[model samples]
Target: MSSVQPYVPNKDFIYRAADALADSHLQQALAKAGRGFVDKRSAAVTRVPNFEAMRDRARAVRQKALQDLDIYLLHFEKKVTEAGGQVHWAETPAQMREIVLQLCARHSATRVTKGKSMVGEEVYLNEALEKAGITPFETDLGEYILQLAKEPPSHIVAPALHKTRAQIQDLFLHHHALGERDLSAVEAIVDEARQVIRDRFLRADIGITGANLLIAETGTVAIATNEGNGDLTATLPRAHIVTTTIDRVVPTWEDASAILRVLARSATGQQTTTYTSFFTGARGDTDKDGPEAFHVVLLDNRRSQLLGSEYQEMLHCIRCGACMNHCPVYQAVGGHTYDSVYPGPMGAVLTPLLRHRDGDYQLPNASTFCGRCESVCPVKIPLPDLMRKLRNREQQEARFKGAGYWITKVFCALAASPRLYRALTSIGTKLAAALGARRGRFSKLPLLGGWTAHRDFPAPQGGSFQSQWRRNGKAQPPVGACPAGD
Candidate 1:
């Protein structure tokens, strides 16, 4: 038997998070981009009367599809073969990369045009192509920006959401041969990128894209985009290759529609993206113009294992990125802080499970269990519950230990005993109140440098809730009433 190597997380998450916090450019970019998504989504949902019902239907479709994943995949394969296209299953990233390379090599592909695909990012497909001496051109505007800057995407839907206009101007000036053209306006930047990529689109032999949903009923791949880059990438090249995960499949076009109804609304606050293209197979004999060859590379990458597990619901994710857009942690530190291809709340749970590596354990702990991710998810994935499951598994596997664990243990033990808990709380509260009576808050405190270093800790004013309740002789509301606790 071959030995499997353990996964090791990127060690730069903490340092990068701190740097992002201090970076004025990144902060400004994030601030400008954050509220736009939130507001647009809010307006979109308000415009739809049955938005919640649509979400429920989307969730149900995903659940049903995952329940019979193998059956649907086989059906999809049969349909694809019947339609004169090919289906390739890859159990790992390495296998997927190799498969794509072989296909490109067979076609003598030199230059490849690419649409935005997170799965490609997962397998580092661009690097693989470059290593094999093939050049890959990013067609998506945001992707092109990141490609020129040599940075991984900060957000899934909006890859360059972390970059400001000033930064983009500098990148374009440094990379493009613009003869003193004024690049200050956003329109100029768009035009510059469009002109550059249009040539690549026409010249490329192969085009690679990710599917929003794979329809098993018709062997069709559906993609949604605002810029129509995916359409150009699919139709312009001699061969079109789809690199996507198994979880993206749906049983039928109806299922795809159910999900699509909420996808754009959740993703960018639009009722639908400007371009929603569907391609089934290679160009038909009567077709005016399309790819000569069609290939689908479906990657498992541990998602198959995820189907039957407690984390199965995560497969329902439509990649709309509503969770991340609303996530406080993602908004504060940005996507690069997570040190994974997927970032924010979804990444926190999904990355560790998919990677199952050493440092991934830290990801689950990254959340405050705020549950905003679950609240905003278009497919209703219980992100907080899944993260908690990972944390519990870590505890059971003894993946974490030390003063923190012991402190939690001691607190739990004390919490179970009312007398001891009261005694400790009373003493601590009195001490803190007395020390900060004049200042009203503590700027520094021993054994709490983590909290005090960034912000002041407000001094305890009143006694414990139980103590206050006893003195007032008032009945307290149930815990559920106070969902947002201090």
Candidate 2:
């Protein structure tokens, strides 16, 4: 899908999604997808006894590589140049766009076909190409659907998850020249897309793709996918342009193998992706069919600023989409609510850093802080901690930080004082008990209507354990104070 850069406030997105979620169909879809993803990933991970150990190794590999990123990047540049390819460093999206535009101009190309690459989405390449009088085509089925509908992707892996099959049939009937043919089944849809994208692949002048991993030691781009669209995009056109973030570098192919083992299991419950293609350079003179010109654009849009920081772990993400698959917020709201190229738990952290750092402040507050994302992450990225850090950064420094800041600060400070905490707890419990509904749930709350907009909040219990202990004349609880399971 192309880039969508309009700002979205967090409150508005939450409310909108909360409303959409009330629909039984959407809720059913979310529940079905969530259980399927969780179960499949669990089964896939169970098959591998040493997956946790591999995660540890993968984490260390990325950490060490990030320490000397510049060295590895220069090494990559040299190797790529030696192999009859070019490497361009783009410090910003605009610079990347300019470079690709210039490449198109040099080639005198009007049509460009793309593999589904998030980096290409990051730079809004299709829109930029269109503005430059070039027609850009998305070859991935989900991406093509979003392209035809003129909508941002709703999920990272399944961009068209929000669209029903009937909606797709209508879309195809309206767009495809097949002119109202029977398109009711999934296989039929697949066949239709394959037929349409074949022509675009053959006639396109330049192809663009994203790399899953960039091997710094060999200057190879590793494109992983269930479909071989990436390979088609990289090799079929006259010129192939790879758009990748600077942080994708790991040190070696060995490291790539380790990460790959975890990526597919986490992403789609497959043992390995159907196609894992590694390209060292342009198709050589001895090679038969590959792009004549190859360009690898290393994009550093705010990634350089992320080095030696708390958020550096985000760089280790392989874009596996595991976090999104397991995320509660993403399962409900999908990608569009975040209103960024990157979406879900990872997007909550990365989007604000990548685009609209000041005014576009809604990206960070889009989570429930459930640690499932971290648990399912193949590289063991501390997503929840990173999210809290982003929220803290916004509260402390971002110009668009919201009100109620002092109130939150006051509560935190009160919690630090035992006497004040006890006093507040007593008062809060009594008030909650007095004002709560018969079922002990509050339908609405002052200054917290957002929380009660869609569902009721359970009221606090009438007494704290500390207060009960005090009343019972016991400073210490019994040995079996722990719950039954404990």
Candidate 3:
């Protein structure tokens, strides 16, 4: 239904990653934002005595919701209808775009204001609206900056985290028509954005936002934000449209509370986001002020198919961005390199499953399997395991081949035979140590040029573990008893 060109994924993620590594501006932005998030989250967690227990509770809530997803969804729809709101089910991105366009058409909306909605980006809703002769204004400061720059979000919670303050000032100066004024401070930038967005909000015919959690019991769409833009976006316009996925539904407000307990702490390290607003359908006769018409567009987009699949655990994601915040790979390459709306660890698993296209298969292979993503996840989604499963699925489907495949096969074969493994490892370690003993590190290696390309690889010290164990009077286990290890 969208007249715009179909979204083309950037297949050159490796190349993009290389470019990101070379980008000084991106590197600085990443370093600054990454440390801030890590420190804040660490401090926030320390304040809560039972943060781990809260994570367990959040995981249980999500798991229970997913187990009976259909029931909760039905109940959600029933409550929305009871509140005089309409619920539209969209099985795919195309269907979602069409549904939203129809809703806009019903209201004859020309100017739409939006709060930060990743689902909107997932479906390319802004482009669709543009094609339909509708103008959508992004109210969130980060999202607004990206909109002006015509770029995708670089971070989930902080969508424009990749941009520097100087870059933002330039963007605002170029896009905003309000005669150049002093824009040297952070307050200046926020004030300017506020002034510009306030006018747009007042003139908007429709407001669109994403839901953090949907409570089936009361058909309440809960949104958490620091800017209060979501509240304005949901309340100001004549019509309010909630664009979100089906996986966001929970059985009750109490379940929503459990997830919220972890969401803010994991995201911005605040005990709670500044503004937490709830919307239930349209404004009633007794209501003082609210949208006249309310609609919720629930997008499946392969999520229903993923319910019983190996990737079902991924649905537990609360979009806290903590996994990505702590991911070393994400820090190095930045979100844009992933070339998907969803980036970082969560994106590595999600983009491939949701998109399922060529080049996307490389995402799962982008990790070092350091397991920090899983450690920081609020819901404790096994990100590393899911990525491994994706990699396995790729290999099973023969999506990976050539040198990489043969190398893995050779390693597996060698690893299967303990005698061969120990012999090769001993010889390899001794050879590496001998070769790099002068420098204590290898600046270059025959088959591992890529590893040494960025930094020196530490030379192995002394004999292999098995050899040292034998030298220390430890009895050697049977050949197959010890798994392959260095």
Q: For each candidate in the order shown, give its overall lDDT on alpha carbons.
A: 0.90, 0.82, 0.92
Candidate ordering by TM-score (highest first): 1, 3, 2
lDDT per residue, candidate 3, 1-486, as tens digits? Answer: 112233243568888898898989889888778689999999999999999999999999999999999899999999999998999999999999999999999999999999999999999999999999999999999999988878899889999998899888888888778885989899999999998899999999999999999999999899999998999999999999999999999999899999999999999999999998889999999999999999999999998888999889999999999999999999998899998889999999999999987888889999999999999999999999999999888887874476877888999999999999999999988998899899999888888988889899998889988788878636654566667893
TM-score of each: 0.93, 0.91, 0.93
Clashing pairs in 2: none
Q: Candidates 1 and 2: which is better by lDDT?
A: 1
Best by lDDT: 3
lDDT of 2 by residue, 173-267 (tens): 77887965789998999899999889898899999898888898888999888777788889988898888888888788998888888888888
- On TM-score, the stronger of 2 and 3 is 3
How far in Å is the alpha carbon of 322 misplaced in model 2?
0.9
For model 1, how does the per-residue alpha-carbon lDDT over 59-175 read when each residue is reduced to its tens digit?
999989988998999999999888889999999999999999999999999999999999999999999999999999999999998888778898899999999998888888878
**Candidate 3 Cα misplacement greater than 4 A, ranges:** 1-10, 426-442, 454-463, 473-486
In model 1, which regions exceed 4 Å deviation? Answer: 1-10, 398-400, 433-441, 474-486
lDDT for model 2: 0.82
